[model samples]
Target: MSQINKKWYQGMFSNEDWWAAWLGLFFFGLGLLSIWGLDAVGWIAKPKTWEFSNLIHDFSWSKLLKVSSKNYHHLHPLASLFITYFVFLILTSIGAYFQKLNVKKYIIGFTVIFFLTWLTWIIGHEAHLSAANATVKGHNYYQEYNLSWGLQLGGGASFILALIIGLIIGNFFKGFANKIKEAAKPEWFIKAAIVLLGIKLGIMSMKAMGFTKELALAGAAAAFVAYLLFWPIVYFIGRKYFGLNRDSAAVLSSGISICGVSASIATAGAIKAKPVIPIAVSTLILVFAMFELIVLPPLYTNLAPNQPIVNGAAMGMTVKTDGADAAAGAILDQLMISKHLKKTGEHWEEDWILSAAILTKVWIDIFIGIWSFILAYVWIKKVDRGNIKEKIPLSEIWFRLPKFVMAYILVWLIYLGIMYFFPDIIGAAKSGAHIAQGPYRKLLFMLTFLSIGIITDFSKLKGMGKLAILYAVALFAVIAPIAYFVAYLFHHGMMPPVVAK
Candidate 1:
């Protein structure tokens, strides 16, 4: 079986990327069955806020398995935890087997990682840890903390904790980190989560289709315009200002301009630059992206207190990695929603702010394929000053394209179609969609945080201080500000829909 001779459909069975699509849609299909009251995915464990005193006072095996979402059947906490572990283990193990990983080790490693993630999730959910003045079911929870500093980190606290643990393991407990490496697949986890996010978007569109359309258009436009300005400016800085070679400048330009690792690799291949250039640039991109993930959520919330949607869309544009961007968006969503709820005493819809950020980055991700191809053609035709007749592979676009996007769009369109033909069922459908997109989606996100931390070693960033400086300057001086302004132009005054009174 020569590589080029493989059929397109073969990807379904072999490619981890395609497996992401399949797994996403699989859960999404179960969610859709919710319209008929199937309640399939609703059994997934969802952590609840608990203080140590309260937990000890009211401890029970049953209490541990509280179902987080309303309008669904409940399970014992132990049952929920075990079922979640069993389900994910089986599904991910299947993927590992097909991907030719050591399934036994992967299963053992994944079990450890999953439990650790859940532990962090549970601890982070402690009212003092995650809660703010945010409304849950229309009542302000922050009133209870009137005299105390509530941490108010929202769900982001869990993510930060998970990453910190992973980083500790990765940097200090290298042996254990290496053992878990087989299961620390952040991209795979996040991609699958992106698929479930489709369900969230689909449900949102059913309720607010017009807003969804407006957001999609704005996101696409913002990304396109940002890319146009970003590439050339960064390229010039790298070449003329930093005194780098053409190839290094081009690779650095795409790495910073587009979607981090993918963009760097794509541009490196496009310009036929040495593999080492992209590899180094990718490391730099990852470390700096982590810095942004930590800094931006708080900064954006403080700076743009009333502009949640704008901040989110801007985050999508500003953060480089999908993992970091989406993670930041999730944190920002929680933080801004909490702040807004505290201010207005109204419940803002969940996920819309996060979606705005993710959607904008998604647009950039989708464009990177086409952008890379153009770069390839430009390099062959002009940059290299070589033969204009040299062939550029159109297949590169498909290879670079984010397959999880198809799952997102598919669920959204299906929900929209249901809304069009059967308006009465929209309510029923939303409950089902919640199972797919709610706790299950969150589990995958937690996995992304831990995996990202496991892979990030700050020590590796030591020798690349100059590259880090360039990334920082490009980010704060150019990327962050312009991305914010452009996002503001498109998304200003656009707010996530509030829950109806």
Candidate 2:
């Protein structure tokens, strides 16, 4: 039960990577039953915007929560929510048991995290915090609620609130944080969410096939160009200016310039660096990712309000971890769509901008295996030939490849198959696909935001002064601007589709 992949199928059941695929596809299968007139996925509960005074005067669960689809309108909101909790608890507990985590601790921790996450989600959906100032399809929550002013954050408010609450616990309440650490698996949650996002991408392709193709190609090009420029510059700076050794510099370079924690681990394994190196670098990555997640979305939304696609692609390259990048993209999508709807009376189709971010990140995620293989080969042959004993294995490529991306691609292909071959069932397929990509994907995102914050202990950066400084400087000054420019070059003039308001 080695966590590291030794055999081709070693981690199929025991790895979080593989579990992401399993859980995503399992739910996806349930959603697909809609094509046969089944409503398997509609039982998941979702929160709605609510006014505090109204709820206090006349309290009802219906005011706060509802099942995802009309087919399950007969179920009580609390019953639906309990079913959602029970289902996730059982499924994730099974994964934890296989992955060799403390099952009891995981269950308890997951329960606390789930309820806390839902509480934050519901609070963030307060009408004043989430309602847009504009009227869309004759519905204006702000006007309906008679609010004088509003933050108008949409779903981004929930994401931000979840992070803040988790951060407070992680930083201030260390004992509680340690208790729940076993279930704070942000990467796993986000990967599963990415798999669910395939449904969104598939639906998008059905609507705008040509634009989807262009966006995918442009994302690939931008990722390639960024890799060429990012690693070398960061490596040179780490080695020359920061006075780090070859292994430290290389690991740090990949962590900062490529994907975050995964790249650090892969690069460290490639060069046979001490495990402590990637662990330390991973701490840096998680902490900084929180900052980027919090700061980048609003900055880009206001700074380049008109360049929605470019901003999203830049977010993909700039944010280090998949969780943070996708979180930032979701926030950017909501903020930009809300801003445009308020100003121009046009609502941009949701998830298109977020797709831009995920598409670029997916390309980067896919290349890590190849990049690490080359690094392993170079380290063995050219860099440290005498020290290394074993030859680099070609199987490392498959080992390091993100399994969830394969699930994502497979889901997308299935949708395309339906679009081309079974066009008539498209309406029914969309009914379930929307729920999978909507409430189900969003719930995973909420978990990711909280878990990411809970795991990130900013106090770890206190002692690693030089490395932290280099990461901060390299990320903000060098990487951010360059990534944004590269994103703009590839994605300029591309815009998200507008919906009738």
Candidate 3:
């Protein structure tokens, strides 16, 4: 085999090629079953009321069946997004195959695509908005359709569903690949994956309004410091105290410290953290994040009503999943709007506030790429190079570097500047007839979720392996959180609050 082909064969899609196991699909089916089983057991039941912000008065199938666009079903708006699960993975894998680039080169390559799309978005807001999710609500069946109402119901639900479904399918396919023989995977695939993930994450951060340079510095500094300190502490408890290795601790710490559990694992993988570490780390982060997602929204609502930006940022940073962060943010925005509803009609202001929070979280996520780079550099310099007396040039950190993410970072910065400076132009452009450009965010998220799902296969997630559960738990869960908290305390509070209100 050619050296390039040889190298590609040992990649992640290669290393963990066993995921074609339908693990994701099975679980998705199981999740449905569990929901059903709960209903059957009377533990949980279908919602009796299908209220649409009190605006959707009619409960008839006809009312719900009203389609918006030819392709989009207003009745089941979620169905469109749900379809992306299959589409996103199939498309991305195809993109990869055709691009035929290695992971490193792929990351470098996406820099170009992300930039062009970003530029197109910058210049073509109207086209963007038209493609977005929106609606014409009817008050008393005579009034125009409620624009916000349609999106909140159809757009949001569908976007979320796409990610969930994507995860299921991606994981299932991955698992099946694992059980099968000689399944091929490309390592550089993650580079492309992360590059796309970064773009989405960067967009989310750009969405956060109050993510000023000073604030970003504070958040990044805090996040980095928190991961550095807290992760090691958790590592000690789990490793020296609980018996785990550096690689395992690295995975858990990375997951908690970054955007989502899966993204964290990918970061760990790029840096070559142990194989099992990413999986274990992601699981731990998910458990904790899910807890926060379910619990923290209400607390923030009651505790920090005036501080939507603060609460939102905290939630994004604290919550492990993008969905949790979004849900928490929306909840906060709604509460703020409700509080102001009686006196002010500035309900839409919450969107901006939520945007601010997402932007901050995205900024923190971007830092993960930087952190991975730093780790790689240090590993090559200190660990790989050994003592200073016997040291080679530390410049080899350049080689260990994942340079492609830099392009993504640069494009995001440029887009952020453009969008911020010309919100009016962009807004008008995005004000498409059917929906606003906001739907673009939804699209980006679906793609991101599907991408994540396609890359993960828990079938290979054996708790015991050359690198075992304890190790991964120690690295991803313990070490990363310790560092994150330490950084957080020094920089600010749990989150950076928006002062716009």
Top-scoring candidate (lDDT) = 2
Best by TM-score: 2
**Between candidates 2 and 3, the TM-score winner:** 2
TM per prediction:
0.94, 0.98, 0.50
Q: On residues 87-197, what C-alpha lDDT tens digit does candidate 1 reach at each position?
A: 999999999988778999999889999999988888887767777665576444456534265776767788888978887988898898889989998878888888898
Candidate 2 C-alpha lDDT tens digits along 282-378: 9999889989998999999999999999999999999998989998899899899988888887889889899999999999999888999999889
Q: Output the TM-score of candidate 3.
A: 0.50
Q: Residues 1-501, candidate 3: write the lDDT tens digits.
A: 332223322332322211211222222122222222221111110111123433245544332222223333332533432342334344344445444435444443333223322222222222111112221221111123223332222222332343344345446555442332111222223222223333333344555545444444555555555455644565466456555566665565556556656556555654566666576566555445544544665676566555555555556566665544554454455445444432242233325345434544555555665566667666656545645544323333332232433433443454465467755444322222112112323234333333333344445445444233553454346533453344335334323333222
Least accurate stretch of 10 residues (summed lDDT) in model 3? 40-49
Clashes of each: 1, 0, 73
